[model samples]
Target: MSLPRQLLLGAAALSLAGFAQADIAIEMHAVDKSGVGKTIGKVVASQSRYGVVFTPMLKGLSPGLHGFHVHTNPSCEPAEKEGKVVPALGAGGHYDPESAGRHGFPWGDGHLGDLPALFVNDGGTADSPVLAPRLKLPDLEGRALMIHAGGDNYSDNPKPLGGGGSRVACGVVKSAPK
Candidate 1:
């Protein structure tokens, strides 16, 4: 093969390889007790030397602490749960592949999908960045990112799953651009 042609092909291959490790982003949308389907914000996730960094650019929130986690499924459609139709039930439980059935802090040994709480400003928007040391870029693919209506206590004692009542917003984790 010609030297110039060989060098060009090699560079192209390297570019393609970078795509496989590209960061992931989730386009968060609005949802309510009524059902699901509304675009509101976005959550971009990327891996760093420390861990997975979650940068959320959200708007139209309730202006408080919202529980955020990675759910098992990719669907954000409303579905019935325990005989009642809950918002984003189609996304399934917290992304607990091990069936841990436990809820705790993101740093603890519980549901692997647990993440840091999201804080929204008085203007009903959140643009802060949070990190999860236990998460990786590939761990979020095909999963659903859900934001609860209330704050997360990071415990299962009085209420389940940090007492973050109701799934209010969600987005599906998809591949990022190269």
Candidate 2:
């Protein structure tokens, strides 16, 4: 092979190889009072040397703003919440294992699990990649992806938890099949 041809082939090979290393898939499912069952969409998380990119294609959602965050647990069943029952209560609070207990902007070093609010269109579909610079793809493992019933102000003033309301949908983060 010619030197120039060989160089071009080598470059192409390296570029394709780079994609293989970034195949981290995280899937989300719909969870009501039943449980974490129906898969609504999947987030393909690609982590570069500097950060992770979460590309999501979510569907079958209500038309409105939903509070999206990473919770500490993997279960999506309804559980006890201050002596009352709630949807996806088993997922626990936002993945604030660090115990920060604050909210407002994912870039503001707020709650560790804080993420950009998810906006669903009137047709009940959302296709946007929400960014979370504070987290890596691997950090989602064993955790849960939650979609709240209401919107998030990213602040705690009139209500707690940004008034996101109850957990409406959830998905457990796990490694893709080999």
Candidate 3:
């Protein structure tokens, strides 16, 4: 085989391999008061050295600010207060990749998982372009994302998003099948 032809074939194989590895899907679910689980959205999370890029399919949501976070626990089971499963808070706290000092959105001092607010449209849908740092596919095995009733200020003061009042919805993240 010619040297140029061999090089071309090698590049083609590498491109295909990269494409196959780049695609990753994570299962997401929303838990409600009846202890019933609903499919709220699916986050196609891609891993990079920087963090995880999540592209969510948003629909059937109320228009307004929604608090989105990575909780510590992975349990979708109903919380004691209500039958609903609070995955965000339920998971525990924010995803602190660096364990750095506390800070707000657009800032990197706080938890690596701390993301910007999720804005919904009147049509009851939201599309998020957010990143969760220090997050690998393995870390999300049992973790889930919770949507709050109110918006997240990303601060602890006035008691808006920081308060974490209600668990509007939640979705458990599972590895996509191969």
Candidate 4:
């Protein structure tokens, strides 16, 4: 084969190999409640350069904004029988990849789990986008993504993420199909 032709072929092969090596698969699941917790909806997420993009499958949700965050632990335990949460702020706190030392989205120094507000429709269904830095496709392999009751202001005024209330729903992330 000619030298020029061989070089071109090698370059093409290398390009294809690089494209094939890109990480693009992400998995999502609907976390089922164990006890007092309310099973609200499901979430489907995928990884992107910005972060982990999320698409929530909401049902029976109340109209208006809801607080969403990436909890530290991967457990989706239900609220206690006394109507109190198992861990005061179980699900751990916000997912902090860089540990920027703050809460709320757009802060740039906020937790990776501090996502944008989730607005539900009149029909009680919410379909929105969220980004979590703590999740890098690899870290999300066994972690959990949770949705809270109230709306998030993305600030710590009345509270971070609008002091979004209780843990309404939860989901565990998995590796996407090959």
Instruction: Tell me, by TM-score, which candidate is best.
Output: 1
The stretch of ten residues in a row with the least summed lDDT in candidate 3 is: 3-12
Superposed Cα deviation of residue 20, candidate 4 (Å) = 15
TM-score of each candidate?
0.83, 0.79, 0.67, 0.66
Q: Model 4: per-residue lDDT, tens digit, 24-119? A: 322222333443244555665555554455656678877888777767766665545467544324456667777766765532567767766676
Off by over 4 Å in 1: 1-22, 176-178
TM-score order of candidates, best first? 1, 2, 3, 4
Tell me the tens digit of each residue's lDDT in model 2 across 12-72: 3433456324456667778766566788887665654434445567888899988988888
Which scores better on TM-score, 1 or 4?
1
CA lDDT of every candidate? 0.78, 0.72, 0.58, 0.58
Sequence-dependent TM-score of model 1: 0.83
Worst 10 residues of 1 by lDDT: 13-22
Candidates 1 and 3 compared by lDDT, better number: 1
lDDT of 3 by residue, 61-132 (tens): 789877777665665555553553443344565655566545355234666555556667788877544555
Leading candidate by lDDT: 1
Error of 1 at 53 (Å): 0.7
Q: How accurate is candidate 2 locally (lDDT)?
A: 0.72
TM-score of structure candidate 2: 0.79
